[model samples]
Target: MGRIIAIANQKGGVGKTTTAVNLSAALAARGKKTLLVDMDPQGNTTSGLGLEKNELDKTTYEVITGEEKIQNCIVKDLFDNLSLLPANRNLAGAEIELMTVDKMQFIMKHNLEKVKKQYDFIIIDCPPALGMLTVNAMTAANTVIVPIQCEFYALDGLTQLIYTIELIQKSLNPDLTIEGVVFTMYDARTNLSLQVVENVKSYLNQNIYKTIIPRNVRLAEAPSHGLPINLYDPRSSGAESYDLLAEEVIENGGEN
Candidate 1:
């Protein structure tokens, strides 16, 4: 069975999607068969992998609603070992459509179960909100990786996110636990960034990743080019940071 890891953060601009995209790509680059699921209605993860969101017919919306099979929705050949389940603005309505359905929170988990053994890792890019979609991701995922921005008000937002995770563990998925906390958009020169890192480490205690993603122009620009940092600029610091992150994740899972 594949490990389903949801890259999530309720707070926006915290590099959630960036981590999802690059980490998935880096894992693929490391010879792991990876699947990137775009659960966020914004579809940045879809497009970030070189997909044109508007041109797609099938997406996460169809899979989540049971209108389409998971195998039929996968977009292959995005990279050597990476495949994607693209999403678009259409996904934004899934929450409302599934509102009255029975076991709505487990919809994603059930859909993914059908294709569980096909990949080594399944990375879900969740929306930056505590909505029904996020709840669905939590219920589906075995674990979650939180990307925190090294800036002001970072810890304030983390408290609520932690509370939400606890609630999900109690009621939805007892197997769900935090995978790790990754610090992103880090600026080593700034005191604020350094301070935020220290605070998050102290609070999280363990399960925090050692690799800090620097605020690089290449990282921010890769999405516009529809490529991951590894493909966009493999020699860039962004690529190096995400590559380190992938190794950390692999090691955390006790994989050789």
Candidate 2:
């Protein structure tokens, strides 16, 4: 079975979607059969991977809502070993619709079950909120990777996120575990960035990846160009950091 991992952070601008797009690309480049699921209604992950969100008729919205099968929604061979379940603004209303459905949190989990064994890793890009969509992602995922931006108030909202995870573990999925925390947007020239990293290391009781994603212009620009950093500018520091992070994820037994 694939190791379904949700790239999530309730706090916006924390590199959650960036990590989701690049990490999935890096894993695919390493020869892992990967599925990138865009659970966020913003569809940034879909576009970041070079797919036209609006043009797609079938998407994660339809899959989760039972309007389409997961297999039909999957866009295969977008990159070597990479597949995508695209999403768009149409998914924005799913939260309200799901609230009226029975076992709403388990809808995504059930849908993904039909195709989990086809890939080695399933990376879900969750929205930047603690809403029903995020709940569904958590219930579907076996693990979570949180990206924390290195800046002031870096730890803000972390406590609430942890609490939500605990709640999910207790009531929804007992197998869900935090894969690790990654630091993003690090600037070596700033004492503040270093201090934030150190503070988080000391205060947060979680596994922190050694590879810190620096604030790279290429990383920020890749999404607009509809390419991952590795495909857009492979030699850039941003690409290098994500590749290292992928190695760390595999070394940590990603297959499990």
Candidate 3:
């Protein structure tokens, strides 16, 4: 069975989507069968993989709602090894639509169960909120990869996220583990960045990732062109940092 992972953070502008897009792309480049699910209604992950909204027949919103199977929803990305269940503005309304449903927590997990073995990793790019969608992501995921930006208030949202995770673990999925916390947009020159890093480390302890994402213009610009940094500018610093992150992620999972 494939490992289902959710790239999540309650805080926005913390490079959550950026980490999800590049990490999935880098994993595919390394010959892993990867699937990126754009659970975020913003659809940045969909477009970042060079997909057009009109090109998708169905989306992750439909899949989660049991309207379509994942096999029917997935589209090929720039890398043949990587596929996507694209999302769009319509996804934003799913939370309200699903509100009346019982067992909403397991909707995503149950939807993915049928196609669990189709890939090595299933990466869900969750919406940046603690809403029903994010709750479903937690229930469906075997683990979560949190992206924390280096800043003073970063830790504020993390406490809420952790509390939410604990509640989910106690009530829903007991096997749901914290995959790791990745620090993003790190500037080595700033004392603030270093202090924030140290603070995150002190808080999460061994759960934090050693590989940090540097603030690179190339990374920030890739999404606008609808390409991952790995494909847009493979030689750029953004690509190198994400490559290292991929290796670290795989190693953490005991995969080479």
Candidate 4:
């Protein structure tokens, strides 16, 4: 079976989607059969992978709402080993539509289960909120990778996110656990960044990946150009950092 990992952070502007896009692309470049699932209604992940969100007839919205099947919503062979289940603005209404449905939290889990064994890793890009969509992603995932921006408020709301994870583990998916935390937007020139990293290392009782994603212009530009950092500029520091993160993730294997 594939390792279902959700790239999630309730806090926005923390490189959650950036990590989702690049890490999935990196894994695919490493010859791993990877599936990138865009659960966020914003659909940045869909566009980041070069898919036109509005042009697609069916998406994660339809899949989750039972208007379509998961298999049919998947866009295969976007890259050599990468596939995508695109999302769009329509997904924003899924919570309200599923409110009356029994066991709605398990809907994503059940849908993903049907295609779990077909890939090596299934990476989900969750929205930057603790809403029903994020809850569904967590309930369906074996683990979560949180992207924390290195700044003064890096730790803010982190406790709440951890508490939510604990709640999910206890009430929803007992197998759910935190895979690790990744530090992003690091500026080596600033002591504040170093301080924040040290603080998180000392206080947060979770595995922290060694790869620190720098605030690279190329990283920021790639999304607008509809390509991953590796494909856009393989020589850039952002690409190097994400490739290292992918290696660490692969090294961790099925441990989490």
> Pick by lDDT: which candidate is best?
2
Where model 4 places Cα greater than 4 Å from the true spot, the runs are 254-256
User: Which is better, 1 or 3, measured by TM-score?
Assistant: 1
Cα RMSD to the true fold for all candidates: 1.2, 0.7, 1.6, 1.1
Tens digits of per-residue lDDT for model 2, 1-256: 8999999899999999999999999999999999999999999999988888999999998997889889999999798899999999999999999999999999999988999999999999999999999999999999999999999999999999989999999999999999899999999999999999999999989999999999999999999998999999999999999999999999987986
Q: Candidate 3 residues 17-91, lDDT tens each?
A: 999999999988888888888899888899877778646659988787778887788886547688888998888
TM-score of each: 0.97, 0.99, 0.95, 0.98
lDDT of 4 by residue, 104-187 (tens): 999999999999899999999999999899999999999999999999999999999999999999999999989999999999
TM-score, ranked from best to worst: 2, 4, 1, 3
CA lDDT, every model vs. true structure: 0.91, 0.94, 0.86, 0.94
Q: Candidate 3: misplaced stretches above 4 Å? A: 54-57, 254-256
Model 1 misplacement above 4 A: 254-256
Looking at model 4, residue 127 earns an lDDT score of 96
Candidate 3, pairs of clashing residues: none
Question: Model 3 Cα displacement at 106 (Å)?
Answer: 0.9
lDDT of 1: 0.91
By TM-score, who's the top model here? 2
